[model samples]
Target: MSIQLYGLCETHSSEECNFYCRVCMFALCKECKKQHDIFEHEIIRAYKVNEVASFRLADLESLRDASDICPYKGNGRLVEVIYKRGDGIACCHGQGNVVECESCQYRLKSPSAKYCSIQCKVEAVMKMNESESVTNEAKRKVETISEESASDVKSFTKRPRE
Candidate 1:
């Protein structure tokens, strides 16, 4: 009905341990524990991050996929940290002026490359021309209908009692 001693120090062989080192998982006696505490207490607890150097594409890929902190070591030298932002440079693109394709979201390689492929560009132009033709035809029909209605109204105004 009494508590038992599960931890015993190896140094003393028969001494009951009072402290446990979780990092190394070692049981220590009072004297050894006090020594470790004295040295550990002298060490600093907080650390700071200096500016990071240039980071490679591979490094950023891992950071994005894993959602982990920068893996750079030694003053953060492996790569520069770039926080993703809406108004900042895009994720897949470099620092250059580019436009999006009218039909799809693909970024145009150049100003001349309006769409992602030739098919898209051609299709867009054809759609524009077809819409223009339809609009013109509709306008002509409206004008003709208005002219005929005006003539009918004039004839009614000139008619005698009938």
Candidate 2:
């Protein structure tokens, strides 16, 4: 299709423009395009959608790399990529930077942070403390029950008390 100059570029609002920012949906001219590029805005030549069609991935991927083009049928653009350092998969609906905690399997907000939340960290500590207490309780109950049984056996051995 042909690129139309609706009016002055959106960036400078004074200079003539031929290109448009796809992400922000703003128009930009040749001179403004250079300045907008520095900011890293995703821009594309505006084209009129004269026709729409239903297609499959096999058809689209064969024409061009699937990664370069959005798999969806209508968008006709590349998928936005968010950078991550770790091998762990992303969290927050595949948008934010998050990694699962090794201890609780919860997603941590920051890649560098260790735990997801204060509660998970607290649960870890409580488990340690609870383990010590639970073991001690079990030992005490065993000793008490054994003593009661031993007393009953001694009473049975004795003759009838007159």
Candidate 3:
């Protein structure tokens, strides 16, 4: 594409912008391009941005590296955006941090997963069953004792019948 002046550069008011910085999302002139180059910024011709099929100004700014502070206390860890779909929602987590399984306390396969594996889920179910059975057994014993006590009390009270 032929080099054309897009507009007056925002940084340098006197010079016209011929290039754009993909990282900073700013239009820059030849003089300003030199400063952007120091940081290895992606500088492209201003007109060519529209020609690129995948170039979207909004997407470029939203996909920047994460710099937000982490929520977990005492570690001062910083969370990073792991993935983002077209829906604009982001799945973020601290670097090297992992979610644990609700049942086994082992590292989970994924953030949304409840148990680490099928075995952990099965074990948790089995434990719940065992506890329920024990509780039922105790209730049965209490009922049996209560019935026996009632029968004995009736016999003793009805004594001396003529």
Question: Which one wins by lDDT: 1 or 2?
Answer: 2
Question: How far is 115's C-alpha from truth in model 1 (Å)?
Answer: 2.2
Off by over 4 Å in 3: 1-99, 109-113
Q: Tell me the tens digit of each residue's lDDT in model 2 across 1-162.
A: 122344576566767665656455456677877777646555654322223121234433433322322222235642211111224443455554556654455454446644432233334556878999999999999999999999999899885889
Query: Candidate 2 clashing pairs?
Result: 17-29
- Using lDDT as the measure, which candidate wins? 3
Q: lDDT tens digits, residues 55-150, model 1?
A: 332434533321222233435333322221122233445646766555444554446534443234435667998999999999999999999999
Selected candidate, larger TM-score, 1 vs 2: 1
**Ten consecutive residues with minimal summed lDDT in candidate 1?**
40-49
Model 2 local distance difference test score = 0.48
Each candidate structure's TM-score, on Cα atoms with residue i matched to residue i, is: 0.33, 0.25, 0.34
lDDT of 3 at 131: 100
Off by over 4 Å in 1: 1-96, 156-162
Q: What is the C-alpha lDDT of each candidate?
A: 0.45, 0.48, 0.49
CA lDDT, candidate 2, residue 9: 60
Candidate 2 scores a C-alpha RMSD against the true structure in Å of: 22.0
- Candidate 3 clashes between residue pairs 3 or more apart in a chain or in different chains: none
